[model samples]
Target: MATLVSILLLLAMWWLTMTTGALAISPGRVVATLTGGGTRIENLVIIDRRLSRLLAGSLIGFCLGTSGALTQTITRNPIATPDILGVSAGAGTFAVLALVRPETTERLLGVSTTVALVPVAILGGLITTGVILTLGWRGGFDGYRLVLVGLGINALALALTSWLLTRAEVEEASVAVRWLVGSLGGVRMGDVVYLAPMVVLAVLVCLRLAGGLGALRLGRDIGQALGVSAGRTEAGALITAVALVSVATAAAGPIAFVAFVAPQVAMRLFGTAGPPPLASGLVGALLLVGADFLAARLPLELPVGIVTSVLGAPVLLYLMTRHLRRTSV
Candidate 1:
């Protein structure tokens, strides 16, 4: 029922995305256009343009949310998320490098400047995650240590990104800055196609592992008693979360806070003790789509990340305060 509500909300948000832009089309006309019965202008605006942005946002959000669920489950901590894995900072560093100094980045990466950003960003994120995993693994995974180690690496990556921006000309840095803030503005159909398979596979994987994840969250002894291998589930969840976030950061330039906020929100919405990957994904879609919608309409116009951060910060504060109260009790 919670998932159903989330889906309905997501659909409603998508409708708003389609119907409420400049030169507004009615909801019925938008549906007709989507179903292939509208004028050229409507098709151009809806199909060729808006649809791609919406799809990209939805896909990115789903991946981030699912990743967050997996991470939170493994760590048994609401605050643990893909953001703590250094993926965003690493991806942003490489992306900024590509945007601000395409020639140097291309030479270093041995890819055409045109295609270097995504792949380079992916490489950077993966490399950063690998480094974190290496240093933070203490006989078994230590969630707290991992977060701490990842923070240091993430800081370095963000610092590198900042230095690059400062050295580059403003024209070169302008595009980099927007990408860092996480906009769906540049998303096109091809990017959506690139992300769909991974997003679908991630969801399926999450579903398949859901039971094990739930048990593992109860603690190791109980998980083993329930015939779920705690080590295997933890490792699988961690790997999946890392991969999903890396790919998403590469694709969307590190949209802020979705991975941190989605799973916790899902848990509260569903009144569950643990995050449900499916519901988290749905809420994530709603959040990003709604953020993009709001971003488009706002007079001060900002990136989707800016909108997400604005909305999510208060939620994070609430969750933190609640957690503090529980611990105090």
Candidate 2:
């Protein structure tokens, strides 16, 4: 009931802000813009321009949140997330690589923007995620080992990203910066259409693996004892997690903490001793809606990524400190 109420509240807030012009587009006006005009200018701009970006952000948030929970559960690491695992970084790397190669980037745009990002992003995500899995394989990818290796990968990826940024032209760098920050501006319907199927598929995969993931928390030997194939479960969960994060990064850049914030909040709300995938999805949707709403209202026009980082970092720090204290005691 609380989850349902929270979803409804966020929807209401989104609608209210959009309708009141607080979102930079009045509600009635935007709707009319949606339903209005054949061959009209404002109508084209609203439908083609605004609505696509809105949906893209929302959908990506849902996928990322669900994936985050699955990743954390599968790896048995509370801090494990798409961003932390270098999935987004790997995806972003491929994306920037494509953009830097004009001939290839042009060829990519031929199909669709979202499609262009998906293939490379998914490949990159899987590869990077696979590396971490391999690194943590013998020890069964426990929380501490997973996090430490992942942070190392993340650091290396960041350095590579900086190197890539330096190699690119000035105009490309400007574009890359915007992509890195994550935003809903200039998104196209093609992007929405292309990304939607991948997101849905990834979410369903996450749902299917939820039981296995729950069992995984009991530790590998116990999970295997219970008839769970630890190897297969981890692989599937990792694939799903990578796909979700890849699609989101490809579609809307890396929205840093949606994965982290959503699962944590969901677990708290559900009173679950561990991560809840479904609950995390709902929380993710709510967080994105609220962040996007505020992004629309605020003077600096922050991206959803910025909002999550600003708000989530402090909360994450607190959790870490509290956990450390408890463990030490």
Candidate 3:
């Protein structure tokens, strides 16, 4: 009931800002525009453009949030996020490469290969996740080593992405930049369609592994003592996390901070003692919806990623401080 109320409250807030064009429009007029009671242009602006983008942003946030929680919990590390594991970079790389491909460009917006951008993004994400997990698992997965190796891989993937961006055409580079900053602008239902299946799969995989995640919190050796196959559990978690982030990033670029923020928020709110997957997903949806709503109202018009960063950075700092204090104690 509380969750429902919170969701409604957030939605109301979104409607209020959008209607009032807190960023630009009068509240009543925005509603009229969406309801088809306003001018054709208003309908085009509000319903066709803004609403679709908002939905996309919310969906992307949800995907990243849950995936991040799953990864953090499975690894027993507060710092674990999809970005750290190179999934976002992998997705970004594949998308950029597709945009630069002549066949893809000629056939579609930038490219027209038999292989679509979504699949390429998913495959890349999976490969990166698999490699990171394999490297982290030495006899048994260690969270400390996992975080270190994941960060290294993420850095390498980012370097490759920068190089690819340089080699890409100016138009492709422009597209890539928008993706990097992670905006929901200009998104359509077709793009959402491409992301839906992967998100569903990831969610299902997470749900299936929830029990294992619970055990993982007690450490791998203990989990193994309790009949949980640490290797399989870790592998499943990595795959799910990668798939979710890959689909989300592919759909809306890498919207920075949602993965990190949502899971942390979930852990705090639920007092899970670790990550809370379901709570993380709900928080993620709310965070994105709220952030996008506020972004929509901004005069200078910041991207959703900017909003998330502004909100997430402080939380990250707080977490670091807490971690340090705990370690010293």
Query: Which one wins on TM-score?
Result: 1
Query: Which pairs clash in model 2?
Result: 19-27
Each candidate's lDDT (Cα)? 0.82, 0.76, 0.76
TM-score of each predicted structure versus truth: 0.91, 0.90, 0.87
Q: Write the per-residue lDDT of candidate 2 for residues 88-159, one digit (tens) a residue.
A: 888888777766555666674676443566777777788888888788666676767878888888888778
Ranking of predictions according to lDDT: 1, 3, 2
Among all windows of 10 consecutive residues in model 2, the one with the lowest summed lDDT is: 16-25
So what's the TM-score on candidate 3?
0.87
Task: Output the number of the lDDT-best candidate.
Answer: 1
For residue 99, what is the lDDT in candidate 3? Answer: 60
The sequence of per-residue lDDT tens digits that candidate 3 reaches over residues 51-161 is: 776667667777888888988887787777887666788777777777666465456554453236667778788878777878877666676788788888888888988
Model 1: lDDT of residue 94:
73
Q: What CA RMSD would you report for each candidate?
A: 2.2, 2.6, 3.0
Over 4 Å off in model 3, which ranges? 22-39, 102-115
lDDT of 1 by residue, 1-329 (tens): 88788888888888888888777999899889989998999999999889988898898899889888888788776766767667778877877878898778777878876567667767777777788878887865576787788788888888999999999999989878877888888888877876788788887888788889888778867888999988888877777777777667766778878988888889899998888887888788888888889998998778888898888888778877998898899
Tell me how far candidate 1 lies from the true structure as C-alpha RMSD in angstroms: 2.2
List the candidate numbers ranked by TM-score, top first: 1, 2, 3
